[model samples]
Target: MQNKKRLMRVLGGGALYAATFFFDFDNEILNIAMFLLGYFIIGGDIVWKAVKNILRGQVFDENFLMFIATIGAFAIGDYEEAVGVMLFFQVGELFQSYAVDQSRKSIAGLMDIRPDYANLRRGSEIVKVDPDEVMVGDEIIVKTGEKIPLDAIVIEGESMVDTSSLTGESVPREVTVGSELLSGCVNINGVLTARVTKEFGDSTVSKILDLVENASNKKSNSENFITKFARYYTPGVVILAVLLAVVPPLMYSDQEFTKWLVRALTFLVISCPCALVISIPLSFFGGIGGASKLGVLVKGSNYLEALAQTEIVVFDKTGTLTKGVFNVQEIHSEVMSREELIELTAYAENYSNHPISLSLKRAYGKAIDNAAITNVKELPGHGVQAFVHGKEVLAGNYKLMKKMKIAYFKGEIMGTVVHVAVGGEYVGYIVIADEIKNDAAIAIQDLKTEKVKQTVMLTGDSKSIGEHVAKKLGLDKAYTELLPADKVEKLEELFAKKTEKGKLVFVGDGVNDAPVLARADIGIAMGGVGSDAAIEAADVVIMTDEPSKIATAIRASKKTLSIVKQNIVFALGVKGIVLVLGAMGIANMWTAVFADVGVSVIAILNAMRVLNTQSIHNSTVPAWEGNVEALSNA
Candidate 1:
C-alpha cells in the first residue's frame, strides 16, 4: 500500500514534469510553480526527513544529499532537472523499499512455522488456546492438516508429517506411537494425541523464530566497515561539495557561481553511497534466508561471515556422522543359520533392556515368546545366559565365552561383537555398531572440496571403532577415547594450528559436546536430534540433521561475501569515476542520478540473487554411497 502511494506520486510528478517540458507556460513564475508542485509531490518526504535529521544533529545522509542537491538545482533555475532528479530518486527509493520487502518476505516465509494455536485435551473436552498457554506434560490433540503446536511425544495414532517448513525436505516423515514430534510440522493424514514435552517459549519453533528475529542484531565486519565509512564519508562529501560550490567560484573571476553550483550539486548526488550501505547487508540477509531454505540456520551474519574463512571442521561421532542408534551390522554363524542364530540370541536377551538387546530383537523382526525362555541369568560385565526351548543358550561378549570355558572365535571387527554359545558349543557372533549417516562420506568430501584444511573426528568411542569410521569416511584425522573436556582441549590445540584469519568449526549433537561446541570458533548443531545444551551453544543449527548442510552453509557464506565484495568495489569504482567527472563539469545531474540510483538498483538485484538457492540446492547429490577411499583419492 505504501509502495502504491509512492508509485502514484512518482507518476503524478512525472506527468507534471512532462507538461512543463512539452507545454511550457511563457511566464517563468508559472512554470517554476508547476515544477515546484511536482517536486513537492515526489520528494516532500526526502525534504522533511532532511530537516528532521538536521535538527537531530544527523546532518548528512542520503536524504540530506538528495535534498540539498535537487534544491540547489531548483535555485539555479534548472527547474526540469531539479524535479526530474527528485522523481528518479523517488523511483529508486521505491525500488529499494520493494527489494528489501521481498528479501524480508523470503526470510519471513521460512519462519512461518510458528503455530498460532494448540488444541488442549482435558478429559474428553478439547479447547483451543494460544500456543504460549500450552504447558509441558499437557495432552494436545493434533488433527490432520493442523500444525503440531509444541514439541511433543506422540501417545496415540499414526500419521505422516510435512516437515518441509522446518527441514526444507518435502518428503513427509512418518510419526507413530512414541515418536518425538517437533513443533511447526503439519500433521498430514491422522489425528494424533501427543503429550507436550516443552512449553511454547522453549519449543523448537519459538527458539528458531527468536533466532531469526535477532539475527540482524549481530553485524558482520563488512557491514560494520560500511557503517563507519558512511558515517565519515557522508559528512566529508558534504563539506567537499560545499567547498566546490563556494571556493572555486570566488577564486576565479572567469568561473560563474551557477556553473560551479550545478557541478557541486551533481557531486553531492553521486556521493550518496546508497549502493554500498544497502546492498552489502542485503546480500548477507539473503544468504541467511537461503541457508534456512536448505535446512541450515545461521544464527547471524557474523557467524555467516566467519564461515567463509573456516579452515578446520571438527565432527562428533555419535548423532553427527553416525546414526546415534545402534544396529546389527553383520552375523557370523558356524553351526546354525544366520536367522536361527540371531533368533536364539534374541530370545536369550529378550527381557534385557540394553541397546544391544533391543538391536537383536529388532533384527529378529518377530515377537519374542518369553514362555519359551527360562531361568535367564545376566552377567554384569559379560553377557546373558538363558534356556530357549530347553536348549542352553548364551549371548555375550568374549568375556562370557572365556568365563564359560566355551571355545569361541573372536573375529577382528570394529564393532560390539555378541558371541553366542549353545549347550556349551560355540555357535557364532553378531556385530552391532552405530551406522554412519548416508551423507557422512559426502559431507566430509565436500568440506575438503570447499578447501577445508583438515577434516577431523573426535569421539568417546573405542580406538578401533573410531579409526574404522574415520578411515571409512576418509577423514584426515581421528582422535578417539576423548572425554568432553578432552574434546575442548583438542579443539584449542586445533584452533592454535589455524591461521589468524581462518576459523574452526565444531559440529556435534550430544549434551557432552556442548562445552567443545561453545569453545570453537563456530559451532554447528544437528537440531533434529541435538541435545538442548548443544543447540543452545551452537552458532549454526542444521534442522535436517544432515552433515552435508555444513558444506552448504560454507558455500552460502562464501557466495554472500563475494557478492558483498563485488558491491563495495563496484559502488566505489563507479562513484569515484563519476564524482571526478561531475567535479570537472563533464557529468550532469542525470549522470549523478544514474550513479546513485541505478547502481543501487543493480546491486540490490545482484544481492537478491543470493536468495535463489536452486543452484546450491541442485549441486548436492542425493547420497554418496560409493567407496570413500576412492572419492578421497580422486
Candidate 2:
C-alpha cells in the first residue's frame, strides 16, 4: 500500500514535468510554476525531513544533500534537470523500500513459529488460553495441525510431528507415549495429551524468538565502520560543495557564477552515501536469516562475522561429537553362549541403577524375574554380584574378577567393559560405550575443507577412548581425561596458538561446558532443546544437534562478508569517479543521479544474495585428507 502511494506521487510529478516539455508556454512564470509543482509533488517528504532534521540539530544527511542540490538546479534555470533528478531519486528510494521489505519477509517467516493459543485441559473440559497463561505441569491437548504451545512430555496418543520449523529437516519425527516434544513443532494426524515441562517464557520457541529479534542490535565491524564513515563524510562534503560554489566564481573573473554553482549542485548530489549506510546491515540481516533456515541460530551479527574468521574449532566429546547415550556395542563369550552370558549379567546388574547396568538391561530387552534372583550385593568401585537361578554370577570390572580368583582376559578395547563369571568359570564380557554421532566424522572433515587451522576435541573420557575417537574423526588434536576445569585450562592454552585476527570457537552441549562456552571467542551449543546452561552460554545454537551445521554457519558467514566487501568497493568506486568529474563540471545532474541512486539500488540487490542458501548446503569431503593423529593434549 505504501509503495503504491509512492508510485502514484512519482507518476503525478512526472506527468506535470512532461507537460512543460511538450506544451510550449511563452510565459517564463508559467514554466517555473509547473516545474516547482512537479518537484514538490515527488520530493515533498524529503524536503520535510530535511527541515525537521535541521531544527533538531541533525544537519548534512542524505535528505539535506538532495534538497540543496535540486533547489540549486532550479535556481540556475535547469528546471527539467532538477525535476528529473528528484523523480529518479524517488524511484531509487522506492526500490530500496521494496528490497528491504522482501528481506524482512525472509526473516519474518521464523516468527510464524510463535504459538498464539494453547488448549488447556481443565477438569473434564478443554479451555483455550494464551501460551503465556499456560503454566508448567499443566496438561495441554494438542490436536492435529496445532503447534505444541510449550515444551512437554507426551502422555497419551501418537503422531508424526513436523519439526521443519525448528530443525529444518523435512521428515516428520514419530512421537509416541513418553516422548519428549519441543515447542514450535506441529502435531500431525493425532490428538496428544502432554504435560508442559516449561512455561512459555522459558520455552525453546521463546528463546529462539528472542534471539532473532535482538540479533540486529549487535552490529558487525563492517557496519560500525560504515556508520562512523558517513557521520564525518556527509558534513565534510557539504563544506566542499560550499567552497566550490563560492570560491571559484569570486577568484576567476572568466568563470560564470552560475556554472560553478551548477557544478557544486552536481557534486552534492553525487556525495550521498546511501548505499553503504543501508546495504551493509541488510547483508548481515540476510545472513542471519539464511543461517536460521539451516537450523543454526546466530545471536548477533558480530558473532556471525567472527565465525567467518574462525581458526580453531574445539569440541566437547559427550553430547557433542557422541550421542551421549550408553549402548551395548559388543559381547564376547567363551564359557557359554552370548545369550546366556548377557542374561546372567543383566540379572546380576539389575538391582543397580548405573548407566552400564541399564545398558545391559536394555541389551537383554526382556522382563527380569526378580523371584529367581537373591543375595544381590554391589561393590563400591567394582560391579555387582547376584545369585541367578541358584548359581553365583559375578559381573564387574577386571578388579572384581581378580579378587574372586577368576582368570579373565583383558582385551585392548576403547570402551567400558563388564566381565562376567558363572560358577567360578570365566564368561564373556560386554563392551558399553557412548556411540559417536552419525555425522561426527563428516563434520570434522567439512571443517578442514573450509580451511580451518585446527580441529580439537576435549573430553573427560580416558586417553585410549579419546584417542580412538580423535583418530576416527581425523582430528588434529585431542585432550583426554580432563575435568570441567581442565577443559577450560586446555582451551586457554589453545587460544595462544591462533593468529591475532583469528577467532577460536567452542562447541558443547552439557552443563559442565558452560564456562568453556562463555570463554571462547564464538561459543556454539548443540541441541537448542538441551540443558539451560548450554543455551544461556552459547552465542550460536544449532537446533538439529548435528555437529555438521557448524560448518554450514561458517559458509554462510563468509558469503555475507563477501557481499559486504563487494558493495563497499562497488558503491565507493562509482561515487568516487563521478564526484571528481562533477567537481570539474564534466558530469551533469543525470550522471550524478546514477552515481547516488543507481549505485544504491545495485548494492541492495547484491546484498539480497546473502539470503539465498541453496548453494551453502552440506559440503562433500575433499579428495585430499588429513592424517589421523592425537597431535597434542593441549
Cα error of candidate 1 at position 336, Å: 4.9
TM-score of each: 0.92, 0.94
* Alpha-carbon deviation at 179 in model 2, angstroms: 1.0
Specify the highest-TM-score model's number.
2
The collision pairs in model 1 are none
User: Ten consecutive residues with minimal summed lDDT in candidate 2?
Assistant: 625-634
Give a tens-digit lDDT track for model 1, residues 274-375. Answer: 999999999998999999998988889999999999999999998889878887878888777999999999999999999999999999999888899999
Off by over 4 Å in 1: 333-344, 347-351, 368-381, 384-395, 400-407, 421-427, 527-531, 618-623, 626-634
Instruction: Give the 10-residue window scoring lowest on summed lDDT in candidate 1.
Output: 625-634
TM-score of 1: 0.92
